[model samples]
Target: MRIPLSDDNGHQYRDLNGNGVLDPYEDTRLSPEERTEDLLGRLSLAEKAGLMFQTVIEVGPDGDLVETAGRISKSPTSEVVTGKHLNHFNVHQIATARQAATWNNNLQELAETTPHGIPVTISTDPRHAFVDNAGVAFSAGPFSQWPEGLGLAALDDLDAVRRFADVARQEYVAVGIRAALHPQIDLATEPRWGRQAQTMGHDADRVSEFTAAYLEGFQGASLSSTSVACTTKHFPGGGPQKDGEDAHFPYGREQVYPGGMFDYHLKPFREAIARGTAAMMPYYGMPIDLTVGGEKIEEVGFGFSRQIVTGLLREELGYDGVVVTDWELVNDNHVGEQVLPARAWGVESLTPSQRLAKIIDAGCDQFGGEECTDLLVDLVENGEVSEARLDESVRRLLLVKFRLGLFDDPFVDVDAAERIVGRADFRRQGFEAQAESTTVLVNREATLPLASSIRVYSENVRPEQVSEWAQPVATPEQADVAVVRLLAPFEPRDDLFLEAWFHQGSLDFPPGLVHRLSRIAEHCPLVVVVTLDRPAILTPLVPFVSALVADYGSSDAAVLAALRGRIAPRGRLPIEIPRSMDAVRASRADVPGDTENPLFPVHFGLTI
Candidate 1:
């Protein structure tokens, strides 16, 4: 299907629908709303159904769309784009920026041959961070690596936040990712939650400020061709998961709010809406008897709750942006070797068609992590779902595509992509931020700012890497100062879909590790650094070390620079470090900093 060209006033216009004449949707001169209405009117029921489904996709080494070889859905990209009519995809695992750009161009070329010439909109989770969770976010890899979201919060500077987002926006655009499935605005209220590293912090006001800044940086003052549209999620907040488990598995499906702070969790989302975030995503965790505005809402996942999605987010808040449900809500998925059940928490008893209908009724526009457009088409044809309802969602989805300028030109400069991604200047900025984000928790007797000539024995720091500033010693007794790096403690679990990647459960260190650290401390002045994904209970181990530092995905070089005084440690605690597991169990899951005698309160940091 070749797009016809029309000549007018020395300019050319594309007949996107190959209709031989110019249609309103093909005219770049018209407003996005006008074009969306025209295109919505022209699309068939099947095409509209295709616009409603957004699922994960993979690109092969040759920059061609390929089937993913995992437990996740492996729909052929060609079939999904042509046969099924899906234009939205969440891409994963491309080798480099050049490869990603080539893949994106190939995908757009495929879409151009469609009857409507609807250019595909590719989205991705956060990919600029160091942590690599297959089920959540990807590693920096070939892109400039920055500190995690928690580290950004630790810096507590809006300008720095803006810079980070702008750099990320440029990188994403270079690789042809029009939509960012990130800027997770959920406040880190529960210290044990595994996803806290992706949040700003525990304070509502602070998180709200960062949320607005992030949207401004990614989408700019307003969305345009140069901007990467941001999806602020998980809507109404997803931080209060019961027992700190994620909602990806059946065991982690429940979200409890014992402190009656549901409204508090919604504050950042309210800010995100006001900032004009392009889209929103509801988490998979079902709220357990959550009450709002003196009325008790039903116990269901946010994606399936009419009161929460329609009554609260739509009616009360007046947000009209696209609401995409969190991944795999309608069908079970294979995550690693384990088979994870569909995260249809409240609607578990409903059939797949019934669940799809309920999600539409709940005011959601698109289904994330699902490729089953045929089911939606079947429902519309059978009168299970009205065509008008489908139009409502298609209209919103089309508006986003038009606003992103994807319908006009969706290609990228492959050579420029290689130049812009992980460039020297960008890498330098990321390293500086990583160093600035290193939080000094304790510095008794001014032990830090150690001389560069001191003999150093390191536990986790690579000897060759630390040799830049200090003499490397084999044992603690042979060194003047002993520096050690350890990850925050987590209870290991073997479950579905790379559950081990998540640092959940108890935060206490094992007795053997504690004894080893104490033994090293007795031999020399000990300096300890912990990479925090969650707030580890450090009261038992804090007594042994002379200096304590906290890092959120900083490189080894950045950590050494902070200790050597080449970089100042200015970061603060984004989430509270509880005194013990007992206090964490007693604290309210929805409340921040409610633990009794926490080891370190929110925003606690020290600087020499």
Candidate 2:
């Protein structure tokens, strides 16, 4: 199990390729750029092609390598790493910190056996938050749990955001997760968009400020060994979703800029590039007859648009970091009986191979959630994509690996991972953040900070946790007050793989639910708390409810603490709460704070 070491002038280095002499790429003292160039020359065409794709890889029970392909992953871990020669992977879940460390070490061992011994660079979506949307993000498992991204935005504290990111970095680094697929900087301009919870609010300036702190926290001052390279995502802004529909499906592929505020969304990205973000991810949405600065944008997905990726991001912004496409842009995803088609958008007619070639031509470095090294290799052999072009991307990818110190040592200490991940201090801080992010929107007649002796009729509030605050009654009639918890309403759809998981469509509460809450208010003063994943229309409930509260992602305990004055609510609304669905429809998708006569504007919050 001992990795053989080579020495050159008393400096020992990992003999990655099993060659006796110390290769220039294996030299520890050399700069990343120099080492990248040395390794670039040594790589075969197939090896270089493999570096262009990053796919999903699931860990087996107890950190064992999966022998078979998973539901979402197209190939097993070994087949993708060794056979396909991929070095980057997006890990789905980690059962435990020690197990994650073990899995990472095992994966690196597999990579070490390869011809070049390229260590795998593990990445993950935001996993320190609530909500377990499989394709988007996973819930915290053996990791310190924190509020969702919107909760952090609700707090709007740069120091707090930096602390959270640093904690995440420590946890990720312990388990050998080098890349963080997050800090989703897309402004929540459209209230009905499903992915709004993952973004900062519609304010460009605040989002831009938070972005600098975010990059600083995740990657430190710069991306180094101690850092988790942050991929500030959905570049050129994915906020202006037409009809508030996501671009993951064919129906929601249009990203319109009807307000002619196309440059407005690019504000945070400019900050990201300035802060030295490790990577960028373009959204699946294609501009729909959109014009930016008097230039008509090609009606292709951002991943396939040369004007956007090459001309705008690369040339104009001068960003040389890796550019990864959103998931499944070239291949259709097969989930059970249903098939989630590729998000080719304007270029849907192109073949899978053609799509890959175009993405490369568009100046992308790697394919997200894809494993098609053979296809890329064929493209090079058939003269569609030149090998020199592949080097440009591969070189960037290798530089990131080198700069991250992966080439020096990829293995992690299993014992250290267990001790550092989900430590008591980290968990306590996360719980406090959850409590602090509880935004009290309406407190009519000072209804909150309720007496502990008061009898409470609870709905959706946990009976055991509610008992700690006040007496829990079976019916509203037997109680002095009613405490109810509700999620912001969204129209349900189950067409695609992750469609149902994403809370898309209408933001209006159902008539029946509103009627039930109104009836409860007649018995006693009602305290209704709704989790505002997206800004929900609260016009109907505002009249009937005695007290209205909003939270991004909070636990029952956190809410109870805020209600009982144990922990005061410090959160403000990050985005406006629309008065009605009519106002939402009339507002420009690209413009911020454009809703007419909003019930509660951005940064609106109250104390008990």
Candidate 3:
């Protein structure tokens, strides 16, 4: 076993390099800059290359590292941690909090056996929400579930945002997750964009306010042992998808700004940087022939554009934090039977090695969803990419690891993780938030706060949950009122690896579903609740319903409680519901609240 050296004040520090003497990086008292520089000096080419790659990893049921088959490349945890020297990972699925904590400890123990004894820094995408798209966000399994990011924005409460982040931070630190890969902060300028639910909203001011609150809650007043470092993402914003197609596919690669509102998208990111966000992730979309501040930018994806990543974000904005690219920028991804092309976008002509070199040249410190350290090492050894350049990124990566207190103690209390995750109080808060965030857009004739004794016919609501609030009847004709729940509409597509999770395409309801709802409305006083995953065209249904409620991933009981007036909904519309698809097509993607004759303006919510 390795022993620690004691200082004059009795504070012990681990001899990480096993050099038989205290090194600056091994000393806890030294400044992060000094420690980073010292660690950079001691690392080999292979070790530094490992620091540049941050890829996805899976945990087995018994707390052992396992490889996932198909699309997600599997690297054995032991080989990746010790042999490959990779210390950063984005954990995918885990059975339980205790198992996750045990798995983390196992990974850290393996790292201790390595030459430098570097503890792994585990990170995750947003996990405290209801959405569970593998490529986007994960569901709140074994954790408290809240509304999606847009749902939080709909509440328009800064304190609520802070509370959610704080609770998530506590749960994450307990499970040995040191970094958060989210709090997207991207404006939902394009209503049909698949990832809008992950954003704060379309308004720059509100997005800015929430961004600061989110960062503060995750990082605390300052980063410490208890804090989880936050990565404010899709940098410079990613809400301007052309034709509402995501940049994950070839057709959706272009991010257009037809309204000349490029700077508007950058507003929230500026606020995040001011609040001291630890890291930033550029999006996959390329700015197609757009000009910002009288200067024409290169028509390339943000990950490959030195002008945007280095010039705009690094130099112009004065941000010096770690810059990580979005997934699959270099190599093609295998999603079951389908293969996704590398999102090189404008640089599709370049080889894999050339793409990796371009990312380094763009001033990115780490590559997300990629594990090609060999290519990076080869580039450095061949003199194509200089050692000094590699050191710059490795230094930044080390600073985050050190700042996160990973070097001191990377393990967690497995028992504590079991006790802390999804605790009763956390669950209560989440449930309460769900009720509070249900937006009541139309409540004509004071129709809400339904009587408990009244007969009610419900559709899409669980029979047990409906029975809790009112008398449930089989037919709409036999009931005093009909309560129906509907999801926002989307055109489905067949694609590889979690692409189906993205609810993209037309927001208009299909004819059959529309007819069913219209027929239900004809029978009795109808109360309709629509979950707004994306802004839906509600012109047809709006006229038929007696009451209209909007939700973003709330539980059935929470919706019933809100309807019963047990908890009043304070949520407002985060995105405007367009009158028709024509208006949506005519409006510019980069501009917010531009829909012509919107059915309901943003911030439109009512309470009886």
Residue 463 CA displacement from its true place in model 3, Å:
1.7
lDDT of 2 by residue, 50-83 (tens): 8989999888889989979887778888888889
Alpha-carbon local distance difference test for all models = 0.88, 0.91, 0.88
Model 3 regions lying over 4 Å from their true place: 1-9, 67-71
Residue 227 of model 1 has an lDDT of: 91
Best model number under TM-score: 2
The candidate maximizing lDDT is 2
**Per-residue lDDT for 340 in model 3?**
78
Q: Residue 600, candidate 1: how far off, in angstroms?
A: 0.9
lDDT of candidate 3 over 150-185, digit per residue (tens): 889998999999999999999999999989999898
Global CA lDDT computed for model 2 = 0.91
Give the poorly placed runs of model 1, Cα more than 4 Å off.
1-6, 67-73, 335-337
Clashing pairs in 1: 335-497
RMSD of model 3, in Å? 1.6
TM-score of 2: 0.99
What local lDDT score does residue 398 receive in model 3, on the 0 to 100 scale?
Answer: 91
> Alpha carbon lDDT of residue 417, candidate 3?
97
